[model samples]
Target: MSTVGKRGASSPRELTRIKDRLSFIYLERCVVHREDNAITATDADGITHIPSATIGTLLLGPGTKVTHQAMSVLGETGAGVIWVGERGVRFYAGGRGLTRSSALVEAQAMAWANRRTRLKVARDMYRMRFPGDDPSGRTRQELLSMEGRRLKECYRRESARTGVPWRRREYSPDDFTAGDAPNQAITAAAQCMYGIAHSVVAALGCSPGLGFIHSGHERSFVLDIADLYKTDVAIPVAFDTVAESEIDVATRTRRNLRDRINSTRLLDRCVNDIKELLDHTEDDDLNDQVLLETDGDIRLDSGRNYGDELSW
Candidate 1:
């Protein structure tokens, strides 16, 4: 249910869905200027002219075009599909029926997990810094303990808000298959966590696979964040979706589930919560302060907020 833009040797323009023109996806190098009558794309020596009527979703690679008629055709069909790639517009007509509920659930769980993981990391850091000093260690320990308590309280609140019962049992590390009665809310929670972990890894400049609290393995950072999001964003969204859709475990499919998860408002709320938490938090002292604290001579754009740009 997500479109991923691959980073290649030849840098292509990032793809974006057009606002105020939901059917239209604009392609630009620096800024949007032109609209196409028809787009011709040649990849691997094969030329393809994407007709407007046939395309449900457009995926544009760098430097591509299509006609206005095509845009009009896309608008006529209310099929929600993603336009991906740089400027060369490809189409993903399938998977429109994919559900997002599971994704949302996963994202929420991840967020909660991450919150816990970060606190654990901070606690470990505090202990490492003051092993024998009981006074400072005790104070920090109390604070860490409070953070954990708050996180649990938040988890309960979020679960109540979502109307989904929290799964207290630990998932087996070996299990990967979807279970009967899939927890769509947890899936969404996990996705959110993955996003947050990526953000933290980027900000902290650490190998995402290497972690302080989460194990050092594939997608360990993602695991960490999934733990965090459960209490903060996922639960609320799950509750809202359930109320709005009036659907229960018996009727929810992957497609409707995806719809619930991809609800723009829900995503925004989740992002906002994560951003708010991060904005208020001070950088950990043990983090590479030399890299994070250095004020360099390198010129950079001043108006941009790094948090605002993070999306997966």
Candidate 2:
């Protein structure tokens, strides 16, 4: 039996070809095995096939057993593989690089390496956050302070809107169980956003660690990208989840966030946002400056940009 039915002769001939793209996926207490280009997920409810090419991120939560073959299929489709703890706590992730062109990555590195350009990028980031505002000559510290004040106000407003108790954002890296309901929900939602952000960054050929606003972390760029949507997406979802008197706040928040992500088409927005910030244009071309070798080392093409359309 085929996982997907064909519509006509011109329809996708390969089962691995995903017809519809999903924003994200979260699975727990299931077994995932690869059959051709699809992943068969089995649990108490029975088995269902997931097309690897269609998913933005596959969150392998607790009790999810996956085979090496499934991973191979997922990688070949340029999807993301994320491992999370029970209840949607992200542990780590891997993703297929969205583009072979190093144009975006090179631009990002160049901007981050220069102080003047980095500050300009930071200003652009702030401008992105406040679309109508002018960030000219705004110091980095001023931006940080402004961001903090805006966040507190955002949390207060959301809590008021959702009738959830307002409190400070708190989470400990060593202990996930220490926060209150809203706090835990926020953490879970943040993790989900991080997973999606990681996939976007990877797909765009951007460095996840090269962050302008934040630095010194493995997922610095992921954090930066995710931060742009946190106030509107994750924070609102967390507050609403807590206000609903749910038994599992984290789970509910994840669901709500996923819904919001889909409804808002967040992954698409993320890709566009990254490209805009990098100043990518229709005439732009990425050089084959970075090529992944069999040994996983990236090599340059004698310092020439690759002449190809940006696929991501």
Maximum-TM-score candidate: 2
Q: Which runs of model 2 end up more than 4 angstroms from their true locations?
A: 1-20, 283-312
RMSD of 2: 7.1
Poorly placed runs, candidate 1 (over 4 Å): 1-9, 12-148, 162-184, 191-206, 242-312
240-294 per-residue lDDT for model 2 (tens digits): 8889875788888888898888888887777778877777754222322444342
* Candidate 1 weakest lDDT stretch, 10 residues: 11-20
Candidate 2, lDDT over the whole model: 0.77
TM-score of 1: 0.34
Provide backbone clash counts, one per model. Answer: 74, 4
lDDT of each: 0.36, 0.77
lDDT of 1 at 50: 46
